[model samples]
Target: MSTRPAAGRCLVDLSAQDRLRSRAPERAPMLRVLCCPPAGAAAGYWRFLVREDVHVLGAQYPGRESRFREPAAPTVEALAAEAAAAVAAAPWARAAITPGASADVPLVVLGHSMGASVAAELASRLEHREGIRVALLALSAKTAPGTAEVASTGAGTGAGSDEDLREGLDPLAPGADAAMVRWLRRLGGTPEAVLEHPELLALQLPALRADLRVSMAYDRFPAPVGAPLLLLRGTEDVTVDPGGLEAWRPVSTGPVQRREYPGGHHPLADHGDRLLEDLLACAASGRSG
Candidate 1:
């Protein structure tokens, strides 16, 4: 998928201090958010989601950005396990839940499209293995994990043609393939420069292929997630149809929240403001912690 921030928001570099924590830098985040980016994405792909009490920690999949030299994860479970460690080390991780008492803060995970699978797997680890209570699990633009096939309405659905991923392409090629770029454009969310620029495109391809491979093959951990669930879908999104959004019903044991927008596959690009609004609501009300 092609990605760029919509005009409503600006990209925030995690390496630098973020305005999201400017108001309450000293206070441990009342809610810690781990947002997994979709295929062909890296950690910093999340646009700034501002809230004084909330902080979004971008999930860093290997083979991209600072992790460029690291090997890409082999399965959705691998990505989840890596992210689980990061969440367990959050500043409030220890402070939130006491020996027998309830948590003081919420641990929230959000993912869109293929990343949604990663988010679900990560939530399972936190709730079942780490014993960390997940306050919320937000999934957007994807069918429920374990569904056999993708929605027929989506463009280029299923695992995708192997050629579309451009695996093992010339590292020094002058540019990316035009037809592949066009296909990606149809998928939505990728930036134009990334689609057209050779060097940037090359850096994104390997991770994209790996992510898609696992994401397409992934199924839920067979344990129902205990976190409150939030399913966000755009009415116009071809990637996930209405029936697909409804498929998340039996995936969770806690309360479930479903919301619809008037956009497409990339909610952050056009509807990030509303998405944050829903997240804020979920954080306050879904406090199983």
Candidate 2:
């Protein structure tokens, strides 16, 4: 099959507010979670986190899903800017972040893999630029930005990800690009059957390639922020080691906490329920708003 997406695949765009509004607006959210999807993913990836008392806002990156027609974010900073702008406009930001503020909604910014880096940057903007307080900045499955280990390994750069798609394909099966396939497998977030299904995988390649390019080319690392941090990693995840998670400590002036799950790169795939339970516990302390 051709790698090009089908014609009916949309090319229009929406304002960030309309494209990525709160999952539930009527309820007074006990906590607000602004999430960034991992490389190759879209807003739907965080659907599991939606709850009646929680407001989930998954920043929908361009060039995928509903925004498939728009240009993909050129860099991590640009994506963070978009998310910052969107969340800054929300009504929740008006809530005071000071201790004991009555209306303050506990805000958390979360992302996994390349999204983790983007989330950190977004959290920085929310706190430093928007004058908002992010109760928790959660980074999952990625090393701290600007860490020497990342430079040494080309982690998140999509480097060394492309291998032969032609080498082992059956004679009758159609050929597809292999770079995304390899990267998805490397990240361990996607299922094996989906990785092998070229047509479906190809449909996701445009956005995936764009996000990988952003990760590979980004220059800015998040400046240290005052917010507390939550670092999540899979115990067996080769993509991010213990040192990488620990590196995040220096990026925050407040408490830096870590949680390990039982899996490889995609620990959340099996443990999102557990993660939500933990986040609820996290919010309890920050609820004073």
Candidate 3:
């Protein structure tokens, strides 16, 4: 991969929203949940998760959406650090300390697929470096960090030639071409129009490939995180083993809960309402405890 300058900041500004639109009163502290999208996806993937009580801010990765021209992050650490910086700088992080609030507002981190590991790293960074408390960490459709290799299907190291890259992605899209369309079809998120267009698919491949490399190359620490954890998996998600989902129990010192939904890999889309309800309940439980 060609070395390039880091991408421009992609954080979405929630502070700019009209205060009247906030369902929570000025004196009422609200939970802020920062979400990280899965590989080959952008922040917009979480737009369907909008809620009136909690603030849902999605982390935008490089080389996608508004950041399409920038280079994708080379490592999971780089991505996590950048995301942490963006979250720490957000106005809500400081607003929690304002006089009207009864207590410090809670912050929760949620991620899906490859983003599970990224969210874990971000939670650790916030807790250790910024002294921020992560009320809960919600992970979906991914195994514990440092364990992906155990179940990975021998995909190429993500650093091979173009043909090798295509070959590695073959299992992901058996009879289809190694294009974004194939992956998008398998994942069931991207719009049909975008997937059908060769030009659009080409535009998404760089970031997708970069994110895959980060997942393949990630090296996680053995130590567990301090925050409570909730693992959500799709019952039909063949990509992640049930045992692997259960394995996350030991990764957190706080309580760990697992829930299964009826869908494939993208359970959030199929079960967004249920997941959101559970996420809020988990975060509240963690905060109260």
Better of 1 and 2 by lDDT: 2
The TM-score, computed over Cα atoms with residue i paired to residue i, of candidate 3 is 0.80
lDDT of each: 0.67, 0.68, 0.68
| Candidate 1, number of clashes | 5
What TM-scores do the predictions have?
A: 0.81, 0.79, 0.80
- True-structure lDDT of candidate 3: 0.68
Residue 15's lDDT in candidate 1: 22
lDDT of 2 by residue, 119-211 (tens): 888888888888888878888887765554433234443342234322212223444355446545665677788777877776776677667
Per-residue lDDT for 152-182 in model 3, tens only?
2212112322343455354356543344354
In model 1, pairs of residues that clash are: 2-189, 2-190, 3-189, 3-190, 3-191
Tell how far residue 211 is off in model 1, in angstroms.
1.0
Question: What shift in Å separates residue 179 of candidate 3 from its native position after superposition?
Answer: 5.9
Off by over 4 Å in 3: 1-8, 13-29, 95-103, 148-180
1 versus 3: better lDDT goes to: 3
Alpha carbon lDDT at 203, candidate 1 = 74
